[model samples]
Target: MTVHFHEASQSVTTADAAYAGLDERHAVQSGPGTFKVYRALGKRIFDIVCVLMALPAVLPVVLIMMILVATDGGNPFYSQMRVGRHGKSYRMWKLRSMVQDADAKLKDYLESNPEAKREWDHSQKLKRDPRITRVGRFLRKCSLDELPQLWNVLRGDMSLVGPRPMMIEQRDLYPGRDYYALRPGITGLWQVSSRNESSFADRARYDALYNRELSFFTDLRLIVATVGVVCRATGH
Candidate 1:
């Protein structure tokens, strides 16, 4: 039984034979690929350092947004426990996108709004959620709502780039996927490459691909691309 995983990247075919495309499913399966040395440590160390350094820059944005949420809304920040490396669950922070009771209201909205339900069914996200605050709409469009996750990155809960961590419900939806094999990332391959339009299955494929093809330079490329992504307001 040969399972396969492929993702977007500068492909590094290794020297080992007999195990082409060896993935989370087959560690024993060897493949001829450039196994970048100390890639994980390098990636994590850089994540901590860069994110910590970025705190000062991010704080102002946080302060401004907190006021926006507080004056008109309530709670400037919200945290949801997302599944991380090896099935570890940790609180992933974000600037509040929807009303405080958004989670509780989700069920009712999903039942009533079939169009919203379809989008969520396909992408695990509601495209035009009415529950989202006015400030949140701009925040989502500008990708500003995610600025708070720098805290998560600093706290060692996430990476600047990696497989996008899934909410427990989202992870449960993809029960067949290997949730425990890799760490949850702040921005995954699917996010940088194509996020809003991509289907969940397609996103899953890219996630697996990124895991097999992970590297420092690749991560660097993702960081650079992220700026473009933000400027273009690519994330929904």
Candidate 2:
């Protein structure tokens, strides 16, 4: 479960080959590898069961966050198109963690700030983004902004553990096909690892690695790690 950062040239070729090899292995190991069953069926079932169990406690927090977010005078929940399994597009839900005009603000901010633009171009994230509201900052810090994605899990648009869903526009930026082979997740190897420290391009490599090591145990370990990340408030 180690995440290695290879040079861009090597990483892309490695990820592409890894995915091709993984598909062949899954086909051949279908019968002997119970993990195959977990990937195909058990994973979805596990997502549903885990979401069901978590909802009771999570709902109240979601409601509270919604009210707090709405105080800024806009929708509390935000949904954006994200690339999902098989290159399909789905609306990924999240509690709004930015101002109502976040996109517009981001565009202006990037255009005015050369350094910030470069950072955004590299990672598609801003460490000191001006678009985030106070409450939104806290929610994102605690990883609570993503709580609404449980519904996406129940709807089969996402899994409890898989690659972090990429924006539709980011499809070409992804270097491997592994992301399209499985559902996007609320949290995954990338999210549990040193995510903030990694470049956006590095995501495809992590996604490929996760696919290569896909198993019930791997998913379980990632889920547990996600809890630790939330507890540590490491999320941006």
Candidate 3:
């Protein structure tokens, strides 16, 4: 199966000679001559249903985490501008998992520690980041810090499964323009594939591949894999 993305239409065209036809509900219009079928519309419905189902369990956990994050004196929630589908911008939310002056501390720490600076420059992350609070460290280790993003999913700023959202400055790190066609997700192909263990280049590759082979089945598989990844305490 080969998948081609059309930038003009912002649609993905799956061209698989051996595969059977797609259901009408999932079909998206390609340009003039071609007909492309993918689950873009269906995916949105799935996201809404999944978010609604998860909210009952998720809300209480979010409330607890909010208070815990506020212990150090600051906003319990953090929001940053992130690039979404079609290069649009949205505020991506998270539980505050770092000190209030995290960015400033990062700059100072980078200046003092050459090894940490190298890691940050390469991966845009520091394994032993000094900006993380004690509570923040625990939140991050178990992936609880990301719970607030369920709101992002509820608000349609993100999907349940898709590409991980990127910071505006990190947009260029994505390998292709095709990536902009899909909305970023709270957890995605890269998250389950290797979590934080993968390199930047490897993450981009997974993102592209996910977009190319996107389908209802693929999304379902990724979602299931995500649960297992979380259970193993393997996420960053």
TM-scores for all candidates? 0.80, 0.86, 0.81
Clashing pairs in 3: none
Each candidate: how many clashes?
A: 7, 0, 0
1 or 2: which has the higher lDDT? Answer: 2
Clashes of 3: 0
The CA-based lDDT of model 3 is what?
0.70
Best by lDDT, which number?
2
Poorest stretch of ten by lDDT in candidate 2:
1-10
The order by descending lDDT is 2, 3, 1
The alpha-carbon RMSD values of the candidates against the true structure, listed in the order shown, are: 7.5, 5.2, 8.0
Cα lDDT of all candidates, in order?
0.67, 0.79, 0.70
Q: How would you encode candidate 3's per-residue C-alpha lDDT over 2-33 as one tens digit per residue?
A: 11121122112211211224333335523312
Per-residue lDDT of candidate 1, residues 1-236 (tens digit):
00112223212221112124444433343232334443446777888888878888878988998888776567788888898877789998888878889877998989988888888888776667778888888788777888888777877777787666788877756643644566667666666545555565665666667666666655666677677667766456
For model 1, the local distance difference test gives 0.67
- Top-TM-score candidate index: 2
